[model samples]
Target chain A: MKIPILRLERILLVSIQVDLTDNDAMQFQSDLVEQVAEIEALGVAIDITALDVVDSYMARVINDTASMVRLLGAESVICGVQPFVALTLVEMGRDLLGADCAFNLGQGLEILRTRIATRGDTRLSEDENV
Target chain B: MRMSELPPAQIPLHETADVVTARRAARELCEQLGFGKADQTRLATAVSELTRNVIQYANHGECVIENRSTATHRCIWVQVRDQGAGIANLEQALTDGYSTSGGLGAGLPGTRRLVDQFHIESTPQGTCITIVLTKPL
Candidate 1:
């Protein structure tokens, strides 16, 4: 089934509550990317607190999704990774590379806000240079 | 241990749904055995990795979970068996970051780290991996 994506201001929030199959994961990636572009979102927050397990494939997909979001001009943050899932990912040597992480959704949104603000500063500087 | 004696719960690993089923069953068994939440999560994650491997590499397999009691301790024993192409280089396969399927190759070795006991026997005919996690008394 499709995981719901919510829009709050310039941020897109996706909370994965179900154990996603490969197909579900792939579909989520496509949907998130498309939604990010359609709304010109500034950031994406993916919460996986309800997910108990993340295999290698899922880890890769999460990383890829973060990269895809960045490619579409949005910052991405992964939130609510359980302690056991963190340990397993580390041990599996599948670090969620290139993806920013947060302890929970609140922190994730805060981080995204900070990152977007920083990006705004950089763009302002670039405009002044031009 | 003999499989016939254990009356184990069997989980067929054929697809992603089966992986979820195996992990859920493992979590229930851990709960019934009085495992803490962390321990329960560990078992569930390990089961997910092993069962997913069965589906990804072997295309089909089965996981057997049984409760075993010894004079000193009680433990849950799990066996995952697959009839498919066995690993040619067991050492490399067990190493971290060695995945033929573009995975991080952490499934088998990471599973070993999570449990108390681990054993494996693989050949061209099939592969059987067994692990045991004991309940602290």
Candidate 2:
């Protein structure tokens, strides 16, 4: 299934609600990159809270997706990684480098806001700046 | 020992879709066996890794899931076997950051850490890996 990527202001929010196969993940990478470039988004938040399993292939795909977003000049954060998935990723020795992580969507948005502000992006207004 | 009498559910691992099926089956069986959410997720993720390996390196394979229960303990056992080119270096395959497929090399070792018991037997003719996860009493 194709994952939905929602656009809010200058941020793209992606919530994965299925057990993604290798093909699904590959498609997601391309789709996300394309969307990020199309809208010129300043930040991306990928929420995997509904995912119960993350294998080596999926982990690598997540890392690659984050890198692709950064290369496109958009900051990305991986949000809502469950405790089990976190433990498995560590055990597998596959760290999601170059991608910021948060406990949940709220934290993820905060990080993205800070990053966008630091980069002098137009997403956050002066009144909302923290 | 008690579970030896029951037939194991066989899942064919021939493609990426099969890997997803296997993972789903594992989670269902884990839930049926009364494993907690964390344990269920752990088992399902381990199953995903092994089944993906079967499809990636071995071309095709099968995963057998069985329930094992004794007087004081109950657990699930999974066996993944493939008839293809076997791993050249078992130790190297188990090491993190060592991958022949340009991956993170976390499949085998990560699987081992997720379960309560792990064993492997490989040869040029085929390879068989077994893992067991026991429910805490």
Candidate 3:
């Protein structure tokens, strides 16, 4: 399924509510990256709270997506990694999901805001006035 | 290949979606087997990686989950089998950072660490992998 990416100010929000197939994960990656570039988003928060399982493939997709977003000059944070999921991912490998992470969407947005503010002048011309 | 007398919950793997089906079956079986949330996630993640390998390499496979609780031991047995070209390098495949599919190379090795027992057999004709998680009843 194509995951919805919502825009809130200069940040992009994506909540993955279902288990994504390999194809869907890849599609989501491209969609988010393209959208980030298109909107000149300052940050992206990918909330995976609803995901109960994150395998190696999905971990790779999330890691790659985060890197791609950062490559586009946007901050990215992965939020709501469940306790069990976190333990499982670590057991699976070292650095399975190597993106910045938060306990939840709220903390993710806070980190994004702090990061964007710290960077200061990177905001788009349209957002600069605000 | 010691298994329970009870019929295993079998799910056929033909495509990517089957990965999720197999994972859910494993998780549900774990829950029914009375595993805690941590164990449930571990087994589910392990099943997910195994099923994905089946699709990516074998093109087709089947996931079988069974309850193997004995009088003194409680265990969950899972078997994933495929009749496609088997893994060529068992050693390298188990090594971390060794992936042929542009993956993170953590699938096989990572799965081994997640469960209590892991066994794999492969031939040019096909491959079969069995993993087990156990706890005191």
Candidate 4:
């Protein structure tokens, strides 16, 4: 299934609610990268609160996707990792998720907005109205 | 320690989706066995990694989860079997940062640390891995 990517101003929001297979994960990765480039988004926040399990493969996909977003010139943050999932990943190994993280979507967006504001770059007029 | 057995639940793994199915089933069983939230997540994550390996390397496999609990033991046992090319290097596979599939190489070793017991038997015919989680009741 396609994970919807919503655009607000120059930012992208993606919420993954279902457990994704390997194929689905790859598809989502490519799709998110394509959208980031197509929209020239400034920041991205991926919410995974609904996911109960983040296995090695899934963790790899998310980490790679976040790096891909940064390579495309958009800052990204993974938001709302469940507590148990965090414990499991840490117990398994280190560096499973190397991307930036936050407690929830609201905090994720706050981080994104703050980073984008302090980036020392020109901001779009739409950002001025926010 | 002595333990009594319950009927095991079996899940056939043919594709990626089966990985999710297997983990979910294991998590539900952990819940019924009165496992804590952390143990449940750890078991589910370990199941996901092992089942995904079954599809990635073996192409097909099966996961059997048995609840072996007794008056003084709360235990959940799991076994995964695949009828495909068995792992060639068990030692290397278990070593950290060693992978044949360009992965992070955390599947085997990482799984070992998540549960109380882990064992593996592999040959040219196939591979079978057994893992168990137990708590004193």
Candidate 5:
């Protein structure tokens, strides 16, 4: 298989823009295990919105991405996974506890917003005291 | 091999959880026919890939599963048929990485990988893919 070329950029001071689902086979490919480092923390978004079911390969990639981000001290959040894909994951018994994922765009943004805001709050309190 | 007509086993709908439903039926049948688990999964994956395509692409389809004990090996046969848009160039379509859609196009080739023998026939009316997996010597 040809390498899955990726485009990454900074967005909103948090979360990198990595468009994984646009063309070609539409999956992030089975090679994402090796490519997880590139998207760690403010990690790349894997769009599972179009897939009706999250197959075994996909579940592995997503899990791997999430774990990589956490290891790098950054949180990974998945966005736009459809309900059926979620169901399939549950049925197939994939655990995403070490990572974070959202069913919709709003939820993903909320995860980012919460993390960024919490960090900002900590910094603000430190400044006020010192 | 000459085409010898064999009785077709008509399975029920409770089995077709998706396109791969026939594979499950194949496993059950394989077990009953004394085929090993590993051998059963191989045949099941093959049948599943074909049956799934039939269900996903065709309005309706049926799985004809056959098991025959031979002198050399215990052989399993499966044919999944669907009355849908037949592939224009079936050979090319069966080629790896040649998808007409967002799918990875691994069904037919993957099916072939799982089985010892494979055959495909398609027309404007529909498609019929046959696969056979055999036990070890």
Candidate 6:
């Protein structure tokens, strides 16, 4: 239930939470993710660097988080991907192709900023239309 | 054998991810040692394939990695050895898509394509396959 978190910037952070425990057949822990949904504003970048991976639940969580964030009106991103971690995610065959991603933390935040800036321009236009 | 004479790592296969961990460890080492991104990718891919082979064929084994270089040419050798059944036909095993076991079938052969040199030796104790990645400057 306790997820290790690193606050990168205000309203944006990284959490090293278990996607799944070793005893469970599931590769990731859904219970922890549900806990993360409780926090307000910004987005949580789950640190998957420690996990070896199996099955697609975590991938589904990743997929769901993207939509989940949009519904919450918060920007989201995934970070800390090592080579094998990425490979296993791909091999598991999930619909992660559209997930906003970064090779590491630094890049992930940068991407989220870029997309958010683009949305800012759109918001300005919507205000003018209104 | 001296350090130079020893080949690439042959990691022990305790888990399915043993090879992946070892290979990633090596690639990290290379990055820490100051190799570029492309070099790390090639070496890591080669090691990953071999480790996957150990799991499929022997179920468990160890990885032995060697870093050997001379002047303009640097070669890293990795071998994934396992104490399981010896390969019956080395040539057939090397052939693309000819896996006796149902894996990607590309692990052994695909690893070969990723590196500069590749060799496999099988005995009752286990199989010692060496993959060499040479960077010529």
* Candidate 4 local lDDT, residue B105: 80
Candidate 4 pairs with clashing backbones: none
User: Which residue runs of candidate 3 sit more than 4 Å off their true CA positions?
Assistant: A122-130, B1-6
Encode model 3's per-residue lDDT on A66-130: one tens digit a residue.
Answer: 99999999999999999989999999999999999999999999999889988984563355666
Q: Which DockQ value does candidate 3 get?
A: 0.90
Give the TM-score, chain B only, in order for the candidates. Answer: 0.91, 0.93, 0.94, 0.95, 0.81, 0.79
DockQ of 2: 0.66
lDDT of each: 0.83, 0.86, 0.93, 0.92, 0.55, 0.58
Off by over 4 Å in 1: A94-98, A121-130, B1-7
Give the C-alpha lDDT of model 5.
Answer: 0.55
TM-scores for the candidates = 0.88, 0.91, 0.95, 0.95, 0.50, 0.50
Candidate 2 runs further than 4 Å off: A94-98, A123-130, B1-6
**Model 1 per-residue lDDT tens digits across residues B5-124:** 556799888887888888888888887777787778778878888888888889999999887856556688889999988878888878876778876567788778888888988898
The residue-level lDDT of candidate 4 at A29 comes to 97
TM-score of 4: 0.95
Cα RMSDs, all models: 4.4, 3.4, 2.5, 2.6, 13.2, 8.6
Colliding pairs, model 3: none
Per-residue lDDT over B18-91 for candidate 2, one digit per residue giving the tens place of the 0 to 100 score: 99999999898888777888888888988998989899889999999988866677789999999989989999
User: Which tens-of-lDDT digit does each residue in A52-124 have in candidate 6?
Assistant: 4322333444556566665666677777656655654444233433567777776777776667677673341
Clashing pairs in 1: none
Stronger candidate by TM-score (1 vs 5) = 1
Give interface RMSD (Å), model 1: 2.0
**Evaluation by lDDT, superior candidate among 2 and 3:** 3
- Report the C-alpha displacement of residue A92, candidate 6, in angstroms: 18
